[model samples]
Target chain A: MLYEKKEAWSVLLRLYHWAFALSIVCLVVTGLYVHEPWTSTQLEAVRTFPMAYMRYLHFLAGFVFTAALMVRLYLLIFGNRQEKFWNAAPITPSNIVNFFKTILFYLYIGKKDHRLGHNALAFTIYVVVFLLAVCQIITGFYLLYPESVFWQGWGLKLFGTQQQARFLHHIFMWCFMLFAMIHVYLVVWNENVAPEGMISSIFSGDKFVEKS
Target chain B: MSRNLHLSDLNPTLDRRSFLKACTMAAAALGLSSEMVPQIVEAAASPQRPPVVWLHFQECTGCTEALLRASHPDIGRLILDIISLDYHETVMAAAGRQAETCLHDTITKYDGKFVCVVEGAIPTKDGGIYCKIGGRTALSILKEVAPKAAAIIAIGTCATYGGIQAAAPNPTGAVGVNSIIHDKPIVNISGCPPNPINFLGTVLHFLTFKRLPETDSLGRPLFAYGRKIHDHCERRAHFDEGRFVEKFGDEGHKKGYCLYKVGCKGPETYANCPAVRFNDVGVWPVSVGHGCVGCTEPNFWDTMTPFYERLPSVAIPGDRGVVSSAESAGKTILGVAAAAIGVHAAVGIGRRLGKGSSCCAKPAASTQASDDKSKE
Candidate 1:
């Protein structure tokens, strides 16, 4: 087999992916603490940094996550073809057929369909997850500031009640959690099954794909 | 012809001391200062009773019935005497054309001077044919009555967020008074049957101040619907302690643990129910060992359904079935993922054993290096 090194990801794209991933990690940890503090420590200091600091870090990470998403979306429109969201998506009839074929390959019932970027199914899932991320941002902020003028005036119109918004924020967190689990597993599996160096792609922006 | 007439002398049902006490209590319930009691007493003691037009539409007449059965034994008489109730379908002595005649006459005589109290929801479906008063649809009746009133008070969840009538697949297109009459400064007293004190306080506040009290975005008086029920719940300690009632007859349930696991919407619902208690008996839904249905909230009927579930159920009509609850669905997904990962790992091990050493060694080394890099 002959292998070629392709520039599958730009440095900026890789940076954005890691930044978004790290921020989501921060958010999930802090958000779960905010939801239900499971700490056994009973520090009685006046300047203790317990729940308050967790919340502050969560808010800061939230801003970073939102910024990363915004920048990624902007780059998807204007960046190179490899970085464009549409390159990975390819929602045509052939791509739809390829999506099923890729699924079959995952189940070990079909031949390998190696690519430098995300598969059609993965792209579809990514799109759905991105939409969920958008939902999280909207609902998260609304839940945080239900009493604000902006929330009372416009947020209520966009999302119904604070309860409903909080529900969505929580549901989306689960969605991201679920996605992260599957995504990490699949990436590791792909790397192990086929020496694609999938995990290191985020840091190196390069992958060696074999073509017959 | 004497100018020195006290409220007790005129009413006879309540003595001077009792009347002042009631006034003070009402003022306090309104979240008003002690000084406002004198103003409330003065307003209630005035010679002229403010004419109140009580309109009923698509409703069960619960709000009026609740008021009648208030904690204060003489609350009914006090409310009636304080306000010259021109017309109320459920309580008025007159009926049929005679009652309709009184409503019309009152609307004409005190067009912009009287208070308009609307109970129940207004149906807008089919030209508002769902409810009628004197051959007039609810929409038309409200249109005619609301604009002429000095102030409108939409009492109960029905007249606030269209209540259960406006729930999902709402055939009648029910809506609150605010949706219909946008011109008037309306106050919404939202609950299944809102606390009688809240209604009394709102009325007394209006009577005392000659203006509506400050309201939230939903047009509900801040004094009653300011804090979440969860904040003041008696079982809040249980919630903070992470002790939850998992099921209906479990030890936790019997021991009066937090009902959050059993779908208590109190955390999401904003009302002073826990503080004030229903019927003033120190017993609310939570006190009675049942979760709050969140009836006071907007779209509660649809949004807060599956009353015993922790999270709202996905509404997918017909045979395809529903997505039980958010938490349950999430747990199921997580369980499936865990199982799938376990199976996949087993499969991977089996394949590796069959393939022997050559296929596994290099990939494992590379994957390990990559994992380390990712961690960094």
Candidate 2:
């Protein structure tokens, strides 16, 4: 048997991945702090603005996350064939068959399968997470600027009230956290079980593959 | 002499100068200029005063009391000169059969020409028997009067969003006026006891414009309910500076710091309480060292409860009898996820060990094989 080293993720895709991950971490931490400030400053009120700083960081991270998502969306449309949305989350018959096979593999009932891009189930979850991120952005802007006529007319009408928007935003943060935990575990497991450099491929942009 | 009489003549308490001052003050409160004062005075002194039919149900009459305490023109002058209060159960000299006759006569005489002011929530459960006036259910009376009136003014949070009566476990199925009467244009003056200035401004806008004022999606006038209390709040600087009252009667409380930590819903409540104040005085809930209870928002009693806490506690549905804040819920879910991941990892390790050392060593062997093959 022969093996080959191949480019799996483009440089831009890897950049987007790390940027998105870092921003998500920053956003989650700052968002929780903004929601409920657990720390207080002993300095003069004029000298310190802990909550404001947390809120500022949260907003900054939110913008970064949005930018990262936009770049990823662009890659999904215009990147290499393997980075395309169809390859990542295709509903083709073969992909669908492999999705169930992958599930069975996870359940320890089937042989392990390797792929160059996201598995069908992982891609499906990514699509859902993408939608959640979009919701979070909309609700975030609504909370940030409640006086905006656009938000007042459209955001409020769609999301109900400010409190409702806040609730959705908070809930979506937890969803991201849940997804992150599982995502990390799955990738770690893949790195250990598969010949591919699953964990390092995201950072190094290359993976080992069996030669045809 | 009677035909040419002025507003001062009708109400002895108001003279020409003070009446002008009141009108000017009202113009300012309504976000109008001094030029609009004459129009306001004209509207107030109009010979054909717009008839108002006041109905109360499922409320404490605090809104009425707040209206009574309004002193820019005073309640006496407001009722006597500004608008013809033909039917109010609390202030009218008539009662029982006489009051009923007055209500019926006013509705008939001014049919489709008067403003119907609803001051409370209407109970709809079991035919709205919870509150009645003269053997007539409040629901029935509202349904009867609201159809004929030109417009409806839902006063107070009770009338705007069912208030406390419509809180969790609402037995009587209390609902706001807008929930019942959807045909007519409704202006919601929403608060525990809405500022009388907001009510007066709405009426003046209607009188000056010959229609109801522009309203938000919630049927609250945009002039008053357009901006959040936090935006116009006096202690907004403190909020920005991260100065908060940690508890009641703390040093921050005495120093008049922000009440964000003390469950002030001012950030969410869209009302001009901070700008307009209450009772013709320059003091609101926040100014007096208390948090805004978000009474102006819809379902405030339910959504903004546990008033001492910053965020509303998420209520678990069904009979689980568990109520937890969103933070706690998030933490709990995270904990469960962590535990599940831990158990899953442990089980995976255990299964690998059970399958003998070959399964565990397979990854390293495969990497070694791939490397050797690549070197071929």
Candidate 3:
């Protein structure tokens, strides 16, 4: 079947996606620094290297990610409804059955695509991932909300403590990782199974859909 | 500013010497009387006495013993005199059902006025069948008492996060008070049997401020469990100097060197025990020649084992040690994800290849057999 670009994503969307990728890298590296007990080399670098600067980078990235989320929510509400992000998260009985089929077919479990519908697996993963992303946003703010000096006093007025923020951050980190794992698996599966189909979607914003 | 204003407001008719002399005499009388002299003085000074109700469950009662054995001259009694400890299960005269009734009465009378002290874990296994008080599970009692209390203080490791009894395969399905009562503010005063002064200081801090004191990440009272024991330990000097006692009763140990090498969990433990020694005797685990067991930390039973062994890997959380590409941003996420996906895809493609080959071979075999059968 032939496919065309959906033009669902704006230029801003691409920028946000790339920027989010950049920040994820920063979070993981610095997060490691915070979690691991420091060695002598790390201690020396903490004093000497731009290690302290990385924390600022992480904060800046998080700030940008927060802004992207605000924009994303705005787009979701005000923009076109044809894109099917809502479709990615359908709840009808038929959609639920189809979702399972697509997920299974995509993973090469039961069948590839039984009449162009979702397998239960990927649908569940998509819903879980979206919810997890929402959690990521919640927990990310909980971390950033405490340290913010300007409106940060807002956190004191709101959630109460930085330690609570840290708790939320630590808890959601594992969730984010689990989501990332599943996300990469799906991306690779689509790429290998139908390489041309996978590359065009993000690069040119088109997807593999059957001929109507 | 308020203190200065209050001092200036006092009448100038009384001389300083007479005033001072009167204070000393009153202090002496209060010390000797064993009555409500201190409480009377405090009551007259302030309008009301803060009431505290302490309850025990699934504990060694070491915390109570520690509380009673205060540092100086029995401040526990002084504390009682100051704050009306109207109901205490361990130390009160009442017993069994009557004691339970006293707790209920205090809860009813004070309502949201009294502070609640819990010392032990709440069992949740089999609908909390493991522990029973007055024919009801501890979980039920906690659900009943905790919500109504003004402030709940979980006063030991057991009460804070189900210390030992809640370890793996936990028979009781033990949980902390906070785990159950998410609405009320809980102050965790955790230790195996936390230093009594820590407890006193927390209560005093509350009395002084009319609010709970600052706490650490684990909801621990910061003033008591802020710094690591290893940070200010006496043998810390020896550890810094790289002089360690390798074995118990070894030459280095005999010299009173650092006990870190022999499995001291002090580095990870956070408490004020080193500064404020136990038993008011200037002695603690390390002082008497034993290593720290890290009893205060969460999952200590799992994370801190070989009570004598050192941690194997103490690397920073995400500093991927010798990976091909180690970018300091976002942790080691992409590589781990990429590797996992790569392996999954590799196996998937390999299976697809095998499937294609087998399919083709089977078709060729069937066709050849048909041809041979026709010739025969």
Per-candidate interface DockQ score: 0.02, 0.04, 0.02
Model 1 ranges with Cα > 4 A deviation? A1-212, B1-12, B312-376
Clashing pairs in 1: none
Ranking by lDDT: 2, 1, 3
Question: What value does the TM-score of chain B take for model 2?
Answer: 0.78
Q: Mind giving the per-residue lDDT tens digits that candidate 3 earns over B247-275?
A: 99998899897787788888778887787
Model 1, B48-151: lDDT tens digits are 99999999988899999888766554555578879999989898899999998999999999999999999999999999999987788999999999999999
Estimate, for each residue in A1-212, the C-alpha lDDT of model 1 and write its tens digit: 78876556655467568768998999999899878876626752322436555665676567667666765675565434555566568577766776888999899898767766778888889889888888887887676555468755555777678877777787789899999999999988888778877788778877887866
Runs in model 3 lying further than 4 Å from the true structure: A1-212, B1-47, B70-73, B314-376
Query: Candidate 3, residues A34-142: lDDT per residue as tens digits?
Result: 5553653545431132343444455545554554444444434322232124434457676676776775676578555422222345546645655655655555555
Candidate 2 docking quality: incorrect, acceptable, medium or high:
incorrect
- Provide the lDDT at A137 for model 1: 77
TM-score per model (chain B): 0.79, 0.78, 0.70
